[model samples]
Target: MEWNISGQDFVTFSRFVGAALAMGLAAIGSAMGIGLAATGALKSMVRQPERQGEFVRTMFISQAVAESTAIYGLVVAMLLLFTTGGGHTDGIHGSDWVNGLRFLAAGLTMGLGAIGAGYGIGIAGTHAIEAITQRPEMSGVFMRTMFLGMAITESPAIYALVISMILIFVMGAPDAVGVFSGNIMDIARYVGAGLAMGAGAIGAAIGIGTAAAKALVAIARQPAKQGPLVRTMFLSMAITESPAIYALVVSSILIFVFTPTDAEAARIFGGMDLVAIGKYMGGAIAIGFGTIGAGIGLGIAGGGALDGISRNPRKESSLVRTMFLSMAITESPAIYALVISLILLFVFAVPDTMSWAQGWAELAKLLGGGIAIGLGTIGAGAGVGIAGLGGLIGISRRPQKEGAMLRTMFIGMGVTESPTIYALVVSLILLFVASSDVSTMSQGLHDFARFLGAGFAMGAGAIGPGLGIGLATRDALTSMAKQPAHEGALVRTMFLGMAVTESTAIYALVVSLILLFAVG
Candidate 1:
């Protein structure tokens, strides 16, 4: 017996998988969020049996908000599966496979997008319940702050939803797959747009949620400082969401700009132009994964600032200033990531077609540059926050030792920032310095592995040192605050620890350098 398969069948099959992804990932986050809210409500009720009503009410509200993202996912899933699932013609036209990829990207965009927002909202809700338990009088304030944070946290997911909607309804809609899906480039655009917005939202949502949680507790501890704390919370959240905005901007460009016109599509039809694919998708990946660490770090620093101000209201100016500096350092990684993404999107040039060897090498180069910046920043971003938090903790405890502590903090932050700088350097070299114009298949594959390995080596290797140096700095600052007389000793110890901790990043740099220049 003989069997036959067609591209439209693949399209139909992809729709099923897309629906599953849309519903499945969406459910996981919302369920986790609901459980988190319930756990907090239960604990708060146990602490204050009489206030169960308020706790339950707040928990329910939080759960409801968290479910909204899942609902968006479900709506898209339903549409993908039911609205355009059947009764297709039998011909394999220009780009039915492109629609299949679009469906998958749309599903992923909505599904992964909701996770951070749902989880962040749950954290805010948990903090709200705890705040109420601590200060029953501040229930209203806690609830309001929680809601505000949850609202802001939803921004990333919303950007993702918009991208998903466009993927489904506009550019590569399943129903209009005949002419609209003319270009093979849509495959790159769809996947990149989905990834850019989807992964981008996670850290921002979580960061905003963290700020909200800290704000609620800060307000509860010092009810009179609610106004200023709330203001700080808003300011911090705004900054926290900026990384996601960068990703969203990149996604918008990928989806809207790279689309090939009908004539151009006719020229490039069914052609997997490797350079364009790599350039667009790599740009998306760079911004998408890169922003996560920055978002989380910003949240940590913001939370520290809120807590510090609550502890010593008179030193509000000092704490806020420190927060600005910490966040600025933390944001460096994301900036580097954004630069790589922009370069991939706008700066890199490619011809319409290439030799097989040439195409694959360029693909690897662009993708490697994206990976270098995106994965490399995670540790640097989060570590910066941890280190910054230590300084904030020290200053709040010993405000009189501001100048000494500030000096120590600055030194620590500078060291903490080194790994990200290394990643940035590695990414730049891959983008501009490395050679990829191979003439043979063996050479192309060699260069491909060379570039990709360098990226992974530097990116994965940088994470540990970024985190370690930050932890060391944080502990040193904390110790000095506890024992101001040991300031000199602590400062010396911190530098020593940082030097040792920095070795791993140096090793990554060495490996990356070898990969770029040593082989072939």
Candidate 2:
């Protein structure tokens, strides 16, 4: 049998997919979290029969908070399914494809936003149970801490809901015009905006989960020190959550603030408007992927530090200070990525009169900048996590060498960050540098070269540092394990090795910049 599909039909199909994804994924996550919390609460109740009412109440409250994300998703999905109607006509600027794309993005925004929240709520809820079971008297303090962490974790989901709302009610509205009108580029912008918050939220969830889990463990271990530990965790979580906020800001700007050129100009550019779409997409990916690593890295570092403090409560002050410093260092790459993304979003411009090749070149630069910074930071984040993990291990083994191990870890992490710096420089050059005078096809080719080169420079540059830092950390841990007394010498040697390993990434960065500006 043969099958036929019209544009209108495809648009309808897109709406269905969007509605399904938004509701399905969100509900799944919420169910999982609620189930997890309910099960934990039951177990806790069994353990503390007298405090059953308190356990049940806490679980219900946490589950309700978790369910809010699903509700946001459902509301968005329902709006997309019922509120919009029909498809684009030939004469209308809006196309069915554009409408479909908008719904697709809306679905992704809500769906992905719920994923992290679910995992986070589960982690937090499980810990809440443990906290209550361990010390029912401190249930009030534990609940407050859990609620705070869950609230922070839900911020990304809220951001996604906001973006979805804008896309459905504002941008995709049938009567909308100007930037909000559903043009190809505008649709791309909406999609990018959705992705920015959705993907960015993943890291925030993990970070919050890590902090929550550690906080629970700490509270159980030292109920008397709950105040200081909870405060520190919340502070760390605030920093960890900053990248998501940055992504949200960027997504909002892309959705509501970015003004595309006039419809006539768009008509003239025709398909070449893809260059504009590419720019927004690149910005989204840059922030999304860039922040994920930072989130996970902060979680690892913070969680490890909390574990250390719990194990060795006397060193609380030192461990907390070092964790803050390590988390800040780990966060630097994401911050750099945010800067690059902003430059791509706000600084780069393509004239309507420019040849298609020039537009393509501009798009290439935007995409290359995004990839360079985004991928570069992933490696940096991993390196920082590894270095922090090693430092934590070393400290746990020999608390006396906490100072030495932290110093060494910082030096190594700084070296690991070199590639991100190089990536940033190349991204800036790509964003700001103009293409040389050349034929249309040649300029396009040159731009493509810059695009690939920037990505290669940053990606390849990052490899050495990531591996070098991991190796340095591994050996440092080994050395510390074998010769705790000689930690000072081991740290010095590890730093030297990491510095040497990092040089290769610098060379790659130099090559990338050369490719970006000096070549073609």
Which candidate wins on TM-score? 1
- The lDDT per prediction is 0.84, 0.75
lDDT measured at residue 169 in model 2 versus the true structure, 0 to 100: 70
Clashing pairs in 1: none
How far residue 398's Cα lies from its native spot in candidate 1, in Å, is 0.8
lDDT of 2 by residue, 1-520 (tens): 8555555676778888998989887887677888888988888878879988888888889899888879988898888889654764433335566778788889888988787777777778877887878987777888888888888877777888888887777775333322222265677788899888888887777677778877887788787777778777877788778878888888888888875555532353342565676678889988977887787678777777777777677888777777878888888888888988887777766445456666666667778778878777877875786677677766765787766677777777777777777777777666666454444777677777777677757765785586467658756865785698787788778778877888888788778767766765
- By summed lDDT, the worst window of 10 consecutive residues in model 2 runs over 173-182
* Candidate 2 deviant stretches above 4 angstroms: 1-7, 23-71, 89-95, 173-182, 261-267, 389-399, 433-450, 453-457, 460-483, 486-520
Name the lDDT of candidate 2.
0.75
RMSD of each: 2.4, 4.6
| TM-score against native, each model | 0.94, 0.81
